[model samples]
Target: MLTDTASLQTVLDVCGVFVFGLSGGLVAVRRGLDLFGVLVLAWVAGLGGGTIRDLFLGITPPVAVSDWRLLAAAVVAGGAVFLLHGVWEDDDARPAGGRRHVTRAVRLLDAAGLALFAVSGALVALSRDAGPLAATLIGGITAIGGGLLRDVLARQVPEVLQRELYALPALAGAALVVLLDRVDLLSPLTAWLAVALVFVIRVVAVALDLNAPRALRSTPTER
Candidate 1:
């Protein structure tokens, strides 16, 4: 049973990896990065989160390092942007509304990937003997860490810090997982339910243009 659960978790993680990898690849292409940079970001965005989680949990060699091929498969899936550049047909030529539509599409794609990482991360933490608080935190971290790493390496502000209600949804999903586990109700069904909840929260946030509170700026005189 344990092995089965682990295997399933891995498959789900791979799916999340592919989604995030595509996001990364798209970002690279937008930034006009060369092929090497595009592939590098895709790989980083796919596995960086899980790598952070494993290292924190004292899992030696981390899955990102040991199970690299799994991440590579995701990068391959993400290579669509690079391989099908012609399909994109040059963004400048597209209408402003069209660009906005694509942006929204990417946000939805990111929400799905975030949900997978958040829920699965909590499960992994629980399996590793982490307490409720730790498991929840780890899960939240797993959801955002890959994008965080990618942004840092790319010299851009992290999305979780600036994007619309990103980290909160991940944390919410992770917390729900912990709650379910506390009640001895955590199962594959409940887990996926948590993922759905996260995704929905993100989608709503996107639709409503929700954002985290911003820091108060000083008055002009104070400045």
Candidate 2:
């Protein structure tokens, strides 16, 4: 007897996981990682956040570990990327033509996945009677943990630290979900609003090339 909203949330959760897994696989292909590496990245990106969420709630085995579907999704995504690379390797021009567009699309989808997972994670935390602050932390971690793992594997600075509007969007979305839920305004509508907020923020940040502040170059006198 799952409620309609609950069911919708479930769908969103799985969809986010699947897309995130696909993004991981895509990146692995671009990097020429082996099949095992691709699948490892895919599973980690797809399930890492949810697993953390479950652990925080003391849920046994974690949802991602317990549910076969999530693993299946990651494996399928990895296999698809591996096979597609085989087909694509024959064409030098095609990679040049499509690589940028595909990368852009993957980034946008990753943003969407982050948004959905952040809000959904907060919602789940709330449902489990977690404190608001704890819920927000859970939400934020769930949103970025996968990407962090992916970056570590790829030998890059994690997205939250180096990328455009990444952590901020997830933090904002999680906070919004908690606030709306507290005010009795968190429903399907509010969830969508939160997602849209995160998505737009991410898109704008990417478009504007927003980045985290770094140490400025020192003058010769200071150096």
Which candidate has the highest TM-score of all? 1
- After superposition, candidate 2 runs with Cα above 4 Å error: 1-5, 85-99, 218-223
Q: Once superposed on the true structure, which residue ranges of model 1 sit more than 4 Å away at CA?
A: 1-3, 90-102, 215-223
Q: In candidate 2, what are the lDDT values of residues 130-185, reduced to their tens digit?
A: 99999998899888887778778877667787647788889889999889978888
Note the Cα lDDT for every prediction shown. Answer: 0.82, 0.81
101-192, model 1: which lDDT tens digit per residue?
55665577678889999988888898899999999999999999988888898887787877489999999999998899888787778888
What TM-score would every model get versus the actual structure? 0.89, 0.86
Model 2 reaches what TM-score against the true structure? 0.86
